[model samples]
Target chain A: QQQVKQSPQSLIVQKGGISIINCAYENTAFDYFPWYQQFPGKGPALLIAIRPDVSEKKEGRFTISFNKSAKQFSLHIMDSQPGDSATYFCAARVYTGTASKLTFGTGTRLQVTL
Target chain B: SAVISQKPSRDICQRGTSLTIQCQVDSQVTMMFWYRQQPGQSLTLIATANQGSEATYESGFVIDKFPISRPNLTFSTLTVSNMSPEDSSIYLCSVASGTNSYEQYFGPGTRLTVT
Candidate 1:
């Protein structure tokens, strides 16, 4: 079962515009949500993350808006640049025990055009 | 953050041939993980390599098909046995670091193309 589901398999946005990717998770026990960015021929890197206690977290131009009640979260890139064009994945993990594993979404390929 | 280097970067193997991918980390870590990214799919965890014990594999993965070896804390190798067209994918290794949290750092993946 895919615990996390992401929408819009691909996206294209112009420079200086807002690029948003949404994700929904089914596991209520999941308390940690993280977004990863990947370029071709490279592995995914942790871009930003948030916990259940926060409604939103921002790191420079990258912002993660999380809704605890809805079990949904989103990543928004402000003033999107062409360099940000890549594949993005959202993941959820439950901190219940020592062997917690990550459940990942299908993925969203974003293209920020200049 | 931990820096990881994976060898070969990529390879194309013939049917019935096997390829071994190596992952080296700069610092010693307690755990190392292997993941596979199939075409048009997200990354899936294949197994977790422990320094002193047998590796723990996830569902749909077997030790015979994908053998793993962790000789020490900083290095590990994954071998894909009996290459098949369906085995083509990107293989990645990751290690968790700092404050003992779930934040993981990954190496540039090795692309495997089986013919």
Candidate 2:
């Protein structure tokens, strides 16, 4: 049913510029939102995450802006670099009593070019 | 963060073959999961491997096709049985930082190709 929807299947931004990816989710049971970065031939790594209680969270150059009422969130990379070129996925977590499961977005492939 | 590793980093199999992938964690964890990523696609959760019990699979996934075994807290195995070309994908294993934490970590991944 595509609980989480992401926009811009692909993106290109110049190095040192800002790169942004947007995501919207439908399930309110999703209490945690996390962004994962993946490189080719590798596993997805957790980049940053935020809770529904927080409007924003920043980890170094990576920032996550969340809107509780809208059920939307976005990831912004300040000073995007060629090293940051990778696929980004937005995921929502819902606790199922004993464990948590994540529903992922389609993904956004970002390319930071010089 | 827990360090996770998967065996048989990649494999190529013929149709009707079965491939088993192993996942090992450095520390004990209560919750472990299996995920699949098709070519150029996002990750999809296959099931949750519970220690000492049968795995809990998500919708669209079943035990007969993707059987999972969590014999202990730090290890699990996923077997893709009677494979087909459509089964080609990268299988990944992940674990929560801890039961009380919200963070989850992933292993490198097992790339499988069925011809």
- DockQ-based class of model 1: medium
lDDT of 2 by residue, B16-72 (tens): 999999999999998899999999998899998778778999999999999999998
- Candidate with best TM-score: 2
Residue-level lDDT of model 1, residues B10-98, one tens digit each, is 99999899999999999998878899999668989999887888988989999999999999999999999998999999999988652
CA lDDT of each prediction against the hidden true structure: 0.90, 0.94
Per-candidate fnat, comma-separated: 0.57, 0.60
Tell me the docking grade of candidate 2.
medium
Candidates' TM-scores? 0.95, 0.98
Give every collision pair in model 2: none
DockQ of candidate model 1 = 0.61
Which ten contiguous residues of candidate 2 chain A have the minimum total lDDT? Answer: A1-10
